[model samples]
Target: MNHYDSIVIGAGHNGLVCATYLAQGGQRVLVLEAADTPGGLAAGREFHPGFHASVAHSVNHFSAKVASDLNLAAHGFEAGADGHSIVGLGTDGAHVVAGAGALHNASDKDTAAYDEYSALLGRFAKALEPSWFRTMPRIGSLAVGDLMTFARMGLKLRLLGKKDLQEFMRVASLPARDIMDEYFEDETLKAALSWDGLIGSRMAPRSPNSAVLAMLYRMSGQAASVKELVNSLSGAATASGAEIRTGAPVKRVVINGDENGLGVGGVELASGEQITADRVISGADPQTTFLNLVGVEHFDIGFTNRIRRLRCNGLVAKLHLALDGLPEFEGLDRPGGRMIIAPSMDAIEFAFDDAKYGQCSSDPVMEVTVPSLDDDTLAPAGQHVLSAHVMYVPYELKGGWTDAARDGIRERAIDTIARYAPGIRDRILHSEFLTPADLERDYRVTGGHWHHTEFAMDQLLMMRPTYGAAQYSTPIPGLYLCSAGSHPGGDMVGAAGHNAAQEILR
Candidate 1:
């Protein structure tokens, strides 16, 4: 039996980040991944001949602190420049471009309103930024460290001054629709601005409580390509003396019982090899880690139920198109930057309404990115890859995900895009459509949720993945969580992994 100080399951970016930190702290760490490569959803795969795409197409808010601490640039990952524009496509060749502190192609009133909106949100995002990197204070904890964390959080908000603090309180819980309506008039611009807040979860523009917080969470960092970020993290982890083994899926986390109750012994691989370790840190989603990997026999009834009841059925699907050449948009010279394809907030809401009943959205909305223009490696010379996040595609489709259903949604997505770029259909060399169920089966994520869990108010901060295990430490001794399902929630941010390592090392 091989033995080590810790065994980190899954080589997703977070797992690699955790392993890197632990190894740097002088612990013998081994990372095991079911996938043949690292990066989890961020792993680039060849979908068609000479064309590649990753499920997670871009990194908008990956932690700069994690990159700096791991020296990721030395390993070939540099954060892209800030202010990449987000384009809202209009059917009649009118589009709105947002970023760099300006809103172009919008009404003078809206453009002026945008500046004030940006400044207010910027201040709020800045105040809340530190909390994402730090371990959230556990509720009802009197520990000096925990208390200080709370104090610092309160102090940061108070420092925003009387009026801004009041505004933050008022706006943080408003639905994305309300916030957008308060500042913008153009429907395209409103929907485009709300995209960041509502993506990757079971949320629409009108879903209140956490959308604004989600947007602010995303506002902290610049964008980077997933391929570079993953490669860099993998390089840094291995360089720090962590051994990562791919294609090794853990069947179960071995448990042993004693007077001190149950604890992790190590893990049993699907191949039947059992390796011993002092600790086991799972990078899988909470339900998969506890209910599937660890087994329900070890957990109390209440905790098991909570894990099962987690609202994690993903509503987003990924669409990847291999184009023979760049498809020109009706209005734009080139489809540069992140483009959004929802005409209005009502369009998004109607899609969400269809999905709420377990049906695929009849009129789906999406965020489109032509990544190959910036990275030539994604496609053949002069060719391109169209990567899109198609939303309101239910994991539990009305009739379940069938070949017919998948094809229907795929065609719908293509048709929606074609409305803006008429030449897109002819340019398609191949298409890869992955529904949420496909993401679950292929990526090993529960419900195919990119965040592993829903990024809602009840499922965030101290209550994330539920109370007993919210701080990374679980009820089972020597077992910890380092996945996006932990503390600061998802999106390639790396804070969960970073915070988990700090807890383990402390």
Candidate 2:
């Protein structure tokens, strides 16, 4: 048996981040990963010959504090200049570009309101920034630190002024559809913005607090591509004295009792090797960590049920196409940037309706980006890689995900893109599509959920994963969860991992 001060399960970005912090604190740590590489969904992989794409396409809004703390930029991470914009495609070969330009079919009134809406959301997001990085305070426990956190949160709201404070609360709970309808008249703009809120979520555009989520998503840091990011974090971890082992899958968390209930001893690998450690922090999802890895026999029924109902089913499918050349979209001003394919709010709602019943949407909404346009290293000379997020893909397909069903989805996505960019099919050299089930198989993410859990009000803040383990501490001693399923609920931010390390150090 190998022994260490701490063993972190899963060497995903968060796991790496957690290990980096712990090792920086002088604790001997090891990160065990199931895959050949780290970064989990955020890591870039070769989907087709000579073309690379991140498992999850978007560069999550990373925290500057985390970046500074981990010295990411010092390790060679860089983001593209700040001119990226989203183009919303219409059926009739027309498009609306959301940048510093006029909106197609949008009135001046709608334009002014859009500005106000963005500024208001920006203020609200700024107010919420403090909470996003720190641990969520316990509901009933009033420790001095917890009370100070609450006071700071309340002060942030108070600083918004009485009128803005009242309005912020109202907007925070309002559905994206309702908020968009109230602020903008153009369906194109509304749909483009609302799609951000719906990504990775099982919720439709009409779900409450989705507007707030969209703002948060909008405010996220657009960092370097996943490959660079993973390399940077991996470098940081190793430099901080953390040992990372890839191709190592943990079979289960080892637990033992010594007159004080159950406590994690370490982890047992699937290869039957046992590594002993004083503490174990799981970077895997909550359900997988608890029920699957730890086993339900150790947990009480109520906690088991809580883990069982975590709502982590992924509703998004990642699509990557290796194109012979750069594809063209009619009426799109720029040659390369992000594109939104949801024509209207109702269209997005209809797509959600299909997924609601376990059927793939006939016209799914997507966010398409050609990374090769910005980072030429992702593809060969003159060639390109198109990455897209096809949404409303229920984890449980009505008839299950069949070859025919997957083909249908692939074709539907290509066909939809062809509507905006004629001859796009001819440009494709090869294509790769990963359904939620595929994500599960490849990433070991239960239900293929990118966030490890859905970002819902019911599963957020103190109630995240569960109130019992909200602060990263599990019911079992010496065990902790550092996955996205913990506080702050996903989307590439490593706060959960960083915060978890802080807790473990304490």
Candidate 3:
């Protein structure tokens, strides 16, 4: 029988990183993944042979500090400058972006305005850097550790004083639209900035506290991002001596019925076999680990029922398209950050509003990325891989996802892309669409919440997942949570996993 020091349930970035760190500490670790491949949502799989498109992950807002500290480059990861997205506002206009150091660029005239806008983004990033060092609690509702983290983090802000607090307050506490409006006069700029505030969130542009996402996003960890971060996952995990099982499915975590409350010491797999360990780390979703697989035999109804009430609406989807040639836009040379496919900010917001009411957005919003323009690894010579990170897909639509419904979405994306790049419809050699249902089943995201749960105020910080569950520990000791479902809610910070690891080892 092969026993291990620690067994991680999922090989997602967070799980892998945690396993790596633990293994590096000299404990034998094993990463068991049900999926054939790793990198869960952050994964990059070739949609068609020789055509690679990154699904689910559309941004590298992953902290740079985390990357530098992890030394991911040593593990083999490289990125290029062109990963930026040029967000267009439906009509022929400039694109607002966050890629590269320049921030944004407009293919249209008015180079001076672009320069000024770009400079402001640089300033914003500077102001955010100091605060990045502070340890932030996981994204959901606050926990005791979160409170302690907040208190410690708050000390770093003494340099900002009261004025900084007041000025920064709007960006974190107000509606995202209002904050973007404060920064840019251009409607396109406003739309682009506001669009991100609600990414992977249940909030809208007008939702209070939605703007915090914008501030938190600029909190780049120094040098780390998507690919680099994933590379770190491999090293930290592999070097830690954790034997990673690429295709093993842990059907359930076996709870030994000891006097210590069935105290989670082992796991069972679909093969009808069990592996005993000193501890079992369920790196999967809390609900999936407890309710779906383990059943109520190991949980109290109050805790299990609360987990059931977790509100997650799988509303986001990613469309990967392979183009024979690079797309040429009307004003610009190629596709960049975001294109206002819905026509206007009103259109985009309306789509989100409809999604709120159990219906799909009529004309959804898209943050398009042309990775071939930046990274050649995605495709063959001169070919392009276009990734469209779409939002406002309803969890339960007017009519659930069907062939017709999915086709409608495809048509919408095509029409939108064509508006910016004429004849783009003809460029597609192959394409793939993943709807909410597909996302839920594939990633086991509990309603496809990439953020794990809703990002509303009620679900943020200490309130996330549950009022106190965000701390990455159950009320019981010797058990821990490590997935995005824990806290600092999402966006690949891996804080939840790191925080949990520290606690278990402490």
Candidate 4:
């Protein structure tokens, strides 16, 4: 067997980030990817003869540490100044466009409330930001580092000075609907803000803490396509002498036995090739890494059951359209950036209600962006690509996602947009639709969940994934989890990967 110091399975952004950091720490690292390319969902592809769409769209939550640590900008990762501004569409053709410093077409009350709400949330998010970069302390460990880490967190909250601290604690677990009701009266503004907490999440906006945790975690980073970002990490890893192999799907993580318990010895490829490494880190989800790759026989029943209980059913569907031309919105001069189609908080929650009973929403909430409007290289001349991250479409549909069901969901999405932007349907030259099932088939992500698991309060911080394995280390020696499933949940942030690498280096 070919041998190395460490082996990382998968080439998702987090996996690549882990490999980069490991290699930088002087470990002989090897990254094995199942796909033919490196970017995983971050890579763009052509579905039509001339039009292309990114596998994943929307870029408002990537970590700066990953970029700076990997020196991605120097390696061709361009950060566009064009940040995401939301345009909330109303049912009767009314709209509100909100940017960093301004809220267009809103009443004075809502506009002022928007500024105050954003600033207060920004402060809380900044305070919580440090926790994203570090691994959570192991449960029951009395180590000084762990004690100090916990103390620092407490001090940060205390420093919020009584009133804000009480407010933050009270609202952290409250329903998003309640928060919106208290802060703003504009239905459009409430829906726009509430959508952030439930995007790609299985939770409804009204679920307790769903709004605060989801939106706060999302606000933790900037959003952008990380194709160049991946390239930069890959380049740095290689420069540090790491080996990355595309199309090398790992069959299983190989374990060897000794007098003591078992440990990860290496990995076996689908082609029957075997490679050995001292440590094996999986950037795949816990289910994929533990049950599928490692096999349940090696673990205790308790551990296997915990992995099985992971909440990973994905509720979002992705839709892309190759437009003949840019479609005009009712009130917007431009159609790029993040545009929301949820008319009210009630509408957003009602969409989730359908999925609760295993049905696709007739009216769904969607986060939309026309990347071609900003990045012209994505489409051919005189054409544009519309990528919509649609929600409330269950992975397990009412009767399964049959051909007609797929078409039904597709039309509903397009029609929903048409209600806000007329002539959108006429401009479509081609379209590609992906249910969670399609995402799983194409990306090999378990449950087609982009974040590996739901980012609920139970699956975050010290209890993330589980209590015993929250610090990246698994029960099996030499095996660790570096996926979004581990900590900080998901959203293209590389904190989990960066923190996992830190644990291994230590």
The lDDT of each candidate is: 0.92, 0.84, 0.66, 0.84
* Model 1 worst lDDT run, 10 consecutive residues: 77-86
lDDT of 4: 0.84
lDDT by residue (114-176, candidate 3, tens digit) is 566446444455555543333346555377865776666566544456765565554557776
- For model 2, where is the 10-residue window of minimal lDDT? 97-106
TM per prediction: 0.98, 0.96, 0.88, 0.97
**Residue-wise C-alpha lDDT for candidate 2, range 193-312, written one tens digit per residue:** 776677788777777655566566457555556677788999999999999999999999999985558888999999999999999999999989998899988888999999898898
Clash count, candidate 2: 2
Ranking by lDDT: 1, 2, 4, 3
- Model 1 quality (TM-score): 0.98
Per-residue alpha-carbon lDDT of candidate 4 for residues 444-472, written as tens digits (9 for 90 to 100): 88888977887877788987788767899
Q: TM-score: which is higher, 1 or 4?
A: 1
How far is 71's C-alpha from truth in model 2 (Å)? Answer: 0.8
- Worst 10-residue stretch by lDDT in candidate 3? 127-136
Using TM-score as the yardstick, the better of models 1 and 3 is 1
Better of 1 and 4 by lDDT: 1
**Clash pairs of candidate 4?**
59-223, 59-224, 60-222, 60-223, 61-222, 61-223
Candidate 1's displacement at residue 63, Å, is 1.0
Give the runs in model 4 whose Cα sits over 4 Å from its true position: none
